[model samples]
Target: MARQLRERAEQHTETHLTLRDLRHVCWDPVPGAVVYVCENPRVVEAAADAGMDAGLVCTSGNATTVVHTLLTALVEGGTRLYVRGDFDWAGVAMVERLLTRYPAQPWRMSAADYEQQVERARDRRTPLQPLEGRPQTASWDPELAPSMNSFGMAVHEESALDLLVQDLRQRP
Candidate 1:
């Protein structure tokens, strides 16, 4: 299964695995191997376009059972996971849940990254929607929540695609 996944990634294809597909298969990752998970499909698409061989998974918003199953398999096999999402209340909540449940680290989902993106948005004159819903705290980074609440804007994953793709390219 790991070989097959690598083949698909080598071809720059987006492979969507269902819960049924992963139920009986084991993803025996290379020890200490890294995989990136994100909330939106656009990041995956962008990575594909860049022909990145690094493993990337998209949850398409809040993770479904399929996402959980895939992540569980990789994590159990000793794969290091880096996850990111939109800079919004709901996105933070999703990240919080994943980080709490898995041994995953935040992938550019920090307060500093948020502030940089906010500045980029402003410089580009791209209008960001005001944050909605209740504020969410990021346990991994103590300053993340306060920084986000102070900005009062939401930065979608699309805005940071270039940085993400660049990171993927740099992965060993």
Candidate 2:
């Protein structure tokens, strides 16, 4: 039997994402198309698993330099962005900041929605981390921040994956 040699491909700095990477892939310019945005990668990754096409973008955390550029491109192309973040002070702040740059809708980011999820989490014994820092008002839904503080628990996007996936799977 001949011995088989398995060689791993070495990765370099050039392997990372760059402006040029997007140039070759011809994405349809769908103005006003719904683009699902998430603060964390897991939520967006699940959306990908559920077969989302070209309209999903995950910030992975706070909007970095690259994120700002990508978001600018999407908005400039006229895609409607719907963003959902963790239910915490930082989350509210992130949404507030994004609103200044782009017109993004807050998906599943409301007082009623948070309350419902909190109830479900309590019933299922899903451990929730406490909300951190002082709260900030959500410009899109003024009630959202107060409601989150009233609940005093952080409900991450991962907790509401199934519901979000349903929205993504719907055919308009």
Candidate 3:
């Protein structure tokens, strides 16, 4: 299944795998493998559109059981996960959950990344939606939550597609 996903990725195609598909599949550990995981499908779409031959996964919001199953298999296979999501409170919470539950790293989801995206929006005269809901702390990066609080703006994943795509391009 992982090899099939890789083939689809090589062809720049989007492949969705379900829990049933993963139930009987055996995953061989891929040493030094890197996969980009995000909350939105747009990042995957953008990477595919750019013809990037990188392993990309999207949760399409809060991860479901299938997502967790896939991630667990990936982690067991020694794949390094780089995770990113919207800059809103819920997004932060989702990221925090993944970071804690899995061996994953933040991908362009630092205080600097949030600030950069906020600045870019300001520069383009684009008004970002004010953040709603209770604020969530970013345990992976201590300063990220404070920075987002300071701005009180939500930076959706769409706004950071360029940087995300660039990161995908630079994947080893």
Expressed as tens digits, the lDDT of each residue in 22-57 for candidate 3 is: 986767788779988999999889998998888888
* Model 2 agreement with the true structure over 1-172: per-residue lDDT tens digits: 0011001111101112345554443555668777777788777667657665435666777887767777787788888888878888888788778876799888888889899999988898989999889888888888887888788999888888888888888824
lDDT tens readout by residue for model 1, 58-104 = 99999998998888888988899999999999999999999998999
TM-score for predicted model 1 compared with the true structure: 0.94
| RMSD in Å for model 3 | 1.5
Worst 10 residues of 2 by lDDT: 1-10
- After superposition, the stretches of candidate 2 with alpha carbons farther than 4 Å from their true spots are 1-20, 23-28
Question: By the TM-score metric, which is better: model 2 or model 3?
Answer: 3
Residue 11 displacement (Å), model 1: 1.0
RMSD (Cα, Å) of model 1:
1.5
Clashing pairs in 1: none
**What RMSD does each model have against the real structure?**
1.5, 7.8, 1.5
- For model 1, the superposed segments whose C-alpha errors exceed 4 Å read 1-4, 24-26
Please report how far candidate 3 places residue 95 from its true position, in Å. Answer: 0.7
